[model samples]
Target: MRPAAGKTATLFKDTPLALDGGAMLSPVTVGYETYGTLNGARSNAILICHALTGDQYVASDHPITGKPGWWERIVGPGKLIDTDRYFVICSNVLGSCLGTTGPWEENPATGKPWGTDFPVITIRDMVRVQAALLDHLNVESLMAVIGGSMGGMQVLEWIATYPDRLHAAVMLATAARHTAQNIAFHEVGRQAIMADPNWQDGRYYDTGARPEKGLAVARMTAHITYLSEDALTAKFGRNLQGREAVSFGFDADFQVESYLRHQGSTFVDRFDANSYLYVTRALDYLDIAGRHGGRLSDAFKGASHVRCCVISFTSDWLYPTIENKRIVHALNAAGVPVSFAEIEAAHGHDSFLLDVPEMDHMLKGFIAAAARTRGLTGGTGA
Candidate 1:
C-alpha cells in the first residue's frame, strides 16, 4: 500500500468501475506519480488533476515528448505547489491514453484495445478511480485538490464526489458544465477523426495506416479554442507566412495557419485518435447540476466544510468568467466556504499554465493558509 513516489505506479482493483452510461469496466488499473514526501500524519498530500492531453509528468520531464512537465512552473521545489513541502500526487486520468486505463489500453475481457467500445466515462468516474488510488495509498484526506481546464472539471467532481476528503479546492479556468459552443467544437474534432478513412472504425491500433491527417486536423481545431482572439492576433496576425503578397494557394500562407498546423502535426505523434474522442465526449458530458437533479448547490451539499477557490481568466472565453461565477454562486447558496477571483490575462484559457505572477501569488497564499490550518510547516518538509 506504500506510494510508489517519483516513478510511475499502478493500482489493480478486482472490482468494476461503474460508468454513468450504465456499463461496468472490470480489473481497473490506475497509473499515477507522486512527488515530495508523506509526513507522519499523512495529511500533507495534494492531488493535482491534469487538463486535457496532460499526463502524470507534473514536475518532471515527459518520457515521450521529452518536454518539461506541463505544470513544472508552479509545482516544483520552492514553487507554489512546493514539492519540498507537500506530497504531490498526479495521475494520468481515466479515459486518457497516457499510462492510464483508456481507449488505447487493452480491455481485460477482450484482450484488445477498448477504442470506441470503451464505456462512456464522466468526470466523476475519473475522480472515483483517483479516490481508489488514494485509498490504496492509505491517504484518508488531502490538504487540497487543484486543477485547470478539464483538470478543473475534475476538481469540481472531486469536491462533489468526495466532499470531506479534501480540506481545500482550487479550480482554475473551468466551468460547471459544457456549453453548446463547447459541444460543437468537440463534435468537429470527433468528425475529423471519424471522417479519416484510415481510422478503420477505431481499430487503427497496430495498423500501419493510422488516421494521422484526421487526428492532426482535430488537434488544430481544438487548439484554437484554447487561446484567445487577442493572443492569436498578438502572436500571429493576418501577416503572410513568407512572401510579401498572398500565394493565393491552400498551402498555409498565413502565420497563424502555419502555427496551428504545427500544433496539429506534433499532437498526432503522441496522442491516440480514439482516446481523444473518448476524453472530449467525457468533457461534453460533464454537468454537475444534471447529476444533482438540476441543482448545482446540491452537488456541494456535503462539501460545506471544504474551502473552495474559483479562478477565471479575463480572456478565457472557452470557459468564461461567467461560468466560474456560476460555481461560486452555487457554493454561496449551498453555504460552503468559498472565494472567487477574476485575473486579467491576454492568454485566454491557457493562461493558467503560463507565467502569471498573480496566479502564483494567489496559489501560494491559499496553500500557505491551508497548511497553517492543518498544522503543517511552511518551509520544505524533511
Candidate 2:
C-alpha cells in the first residue's frame, strides 16, 4: 500500500541533505499536504507539525484507515485553526515510513531498502527539512508553527534553529528534553521490536514476512503511556471482554487487554516496524539542552523575538506539567513573550490530540492574538 494518497511529493536533488549524524541524502524526498489558500502576501500560513504515527493528512481523510483527519476537530473552515483564514500545512517527517524517504526507501548502494543502514536523524534534522519545504512553497515566514508531542519537539527545534522564520510557535504536551523515564519507556518499545524473531536485523523487507507482531507490541506499549490510569479505569478497568467472567487463559480476558490487542493489530496495518524503530530512536536522542551546553534557556536565546506558548495536560505523566513548565520557564529566561497553561485533562499525553474544549479555547485565543499582531487581514509584516 502507498504511504499517502493525493499528497504532494518533492524531490530535492543536487543539494545534499546533511543529517545531524554527519550523513547525507543527496536526493531526499518529502511528502506534504496543504489546506486553504495562501494569502497574497503569504502572511497567513500556519504549519501544523504532527506527532509520531501521524502523517501529513492533517485535515484530510487517511487513505489507508479511512478515518477523518486526526485533527478534524481543529482545522476545518470554521474550526479553531479556521481553514477560512489560514493556509495550513503538514508534512511527514524525514525518517517516517510515510511518503517521505525513510528506512523503507531503497539504498542505491545496497540495492535494497535502507533499513538499519539509514543514518540516525534528530528533531533538528526534521525541522531543517521542513524549512526547506517552506522555501519550496515560497512561504518566507509563517504566522505560526504548532505541534504536540514529538511534533512539539520539532517546533522547539524550529524556534531554536529557525527562530526568525516563524512569527509565533506553540508546543503542546511536550518538554525541552526527554526525561529518564521517557527514554526508559521508549527503550522498552524498541527492545520489543528487536526481540521479534522476524525483525531480521531491520532487514525484514522483501523477506515474505514482517515484524508485525513486534511492531504491534511496540505500538501497544507506547499507547498505554499516552493515556492516564484514570482514563484506563474509566474506559476499560478490570471489565471482562464480552463475557461475565475471566477466560482463565491468556486470550485477552479483560476489556483493556482486548482493547490494546486491537490497537496493536490495527497499528501494524498502516505503520512500518522499521520506521517505528527509526522514529523512536530519533525521539530517544532528543536533548535540546545538551546541544546548548546543558542549559535549556540557552537553547532559546535567539528566540526572544518569537511569541511562544507551552501547554501541558494535568494527567500527562509521560511528559508531565512540570516538564512542560520547565520549557516555559526557559522561554521566559530567554526573554521571549510566552503563554503557559495546564489544562485539566484526564486523557494524559494524548489529551492534546483529543476533543478538549479548554485546549481549543486556549489555542484559539493565542492564535487569534498572534494573528492580529501579524496583521493577518492586511499588509505582510515584510
Candidate 3:
C-alpha cells in the first residue's frame, strides 16, 4: 500500500554525515513520526527507538499492513508511555528500507539503486543519524529514550556517544555484545540470502525479480531466535496443518512449519533483502565493551547522571537474563542510577513487544517518576 499522507515526515540534509566506514554520506534522509505536543519547555519529549523490522509507526496505524502500531498497547493517550503527557518520536534507522535512506534508495551519482554499494553501517552510525534528526527537530535533550533488542543496542550507543543529551534510558532484552552463537545464526541467514539465484550479487533491483525465497528463509531463521522453545511448543505442539495426519513428505505438514512459512513470506513484503544483510551485519559488530577499553563499565562512565531501567525476560535465550544483568552490572560499576528487572515470562526476547502486566506497570512507574523529576507533571509541570 502507498504511504498515507502526513503520517510520516522525511528530513533531508545536504551536509555530510560521517560514517564509521570512513565514508561521507551527504544528502541524508530520515523518515520519522511524532505524536502529542512538545510542551513549551520541550522537556517532556521521549524518543522511541524501534526494533529490527519496525518503522516510524509507533502509535499509529501502519500504512502497509493496516494494523495498529507495533507499540500501541503501551503508547497512547492513557497508556503507559502516555502521549497525553509526553511527545513521542520514532524514526526508521539509517539502513532501514521503510522511509529512511538505505541500500534500496537510488544513488544520485550512479543513477541506480545503491544495493550493496551502500556504506557498511554500525549501531553508532545509526545513532549518529538519529542525533542529526533531533538537531533538525530542535530537540536538544530527551526526557527519556526507550528501546528493545536491536533498539536497545542503539540506546547503548546513545548513552555512550551522547551521554549529556540523554536524561533517562530504558533497555530491554539486549546485550553488551553479540555472542558467538548470535553471530553464527546471523551468518546462516546471510548465506541463505547470498545463495539465492535471484540475488545477482545484491544487484537484482533492475531485474524485476527478488531473492524472496532466500530472504524468507533468513526471516524464518531469525524469527526463531526471537522466540523461546517452550513458547513454540505450547503454541504449535505436535499439531498438523489442515490435515488429520502427517503427509510423510517434505511439505509443511506441521502447524509450526506453516507458521514459520507465513512469517517469512509476510516479512519480505515490507523488508528489503539487502537491508536485512546490512542490519544483521551491524548487529554482529555490536560491542559496547570493545569500543570502550574492553570494559563494559567504561561504556557508561559518562552517563552517571542518566536514570536507567534494564529489563529482561526469563525465557529470552537470544539475549538472556544473564546478558541484561551484565548491563545492570556495568551501570552499577559506573555509578549510574539504575533499576533492573527480570520479568518471569515464557515468550522469550519478543516478550518486550507483547502484553506483560508487570512490564507495563514497571515502565509506567519509572517513566512517571522521571517525568516528575523533569518537571513535566504535577505542580512542576504547571
lDDT of each: 0.87, 0.88, 0.88
Error of 2 at 175 (Å): 1.2
- Cα RMSD (Å) between model 2 and the true structure? 2.3
Candidate 1 per-residue lDDT over residues 1-382, each given as its tens digit: 1112244445545677787889887766776788999889998999999988887889898766789999999888887788888899999888887777888778877888887788888888889889988988889999999999999999999888898899999999999999999999999999999999999899877677888899999999999999999999999889888879888789988999999999999988777888888889999999999978989999998998888889999999999999999999999999988888999999999999999888877877888888887889759432
Which rank order by lDDT, best down to worst? 2, 3, 1
Would you list the clashing residue pairs of candidate 3? Answer: none
Q: In terms of TM-score, which candidate is strongest?
A: 2
* Global local distance difference test of model 1: 0.87
The digit string of per-residue lDDT tens for model 3 on 168-189 reads: 9999999879999999999999
- Model 2 Cα lDDT, one tens digit per residue, 180-214: 88888888888998999899999888787888898
Kindly give the stretch of ten consecutive residues in candidate 2 with the minimal lDDT sum. Answer: 373-382
Q: After superposition, how far is residue 190 of candidate 3 from its true place, in Å?
A: 0.8
Q: Against the true structure, what is each candidate's TM-score? A: 0.96, 0.97, 0.96
Query: Which residue segments of model 2 deviate by more than 4 Å?
Result: 1-5, 378-382
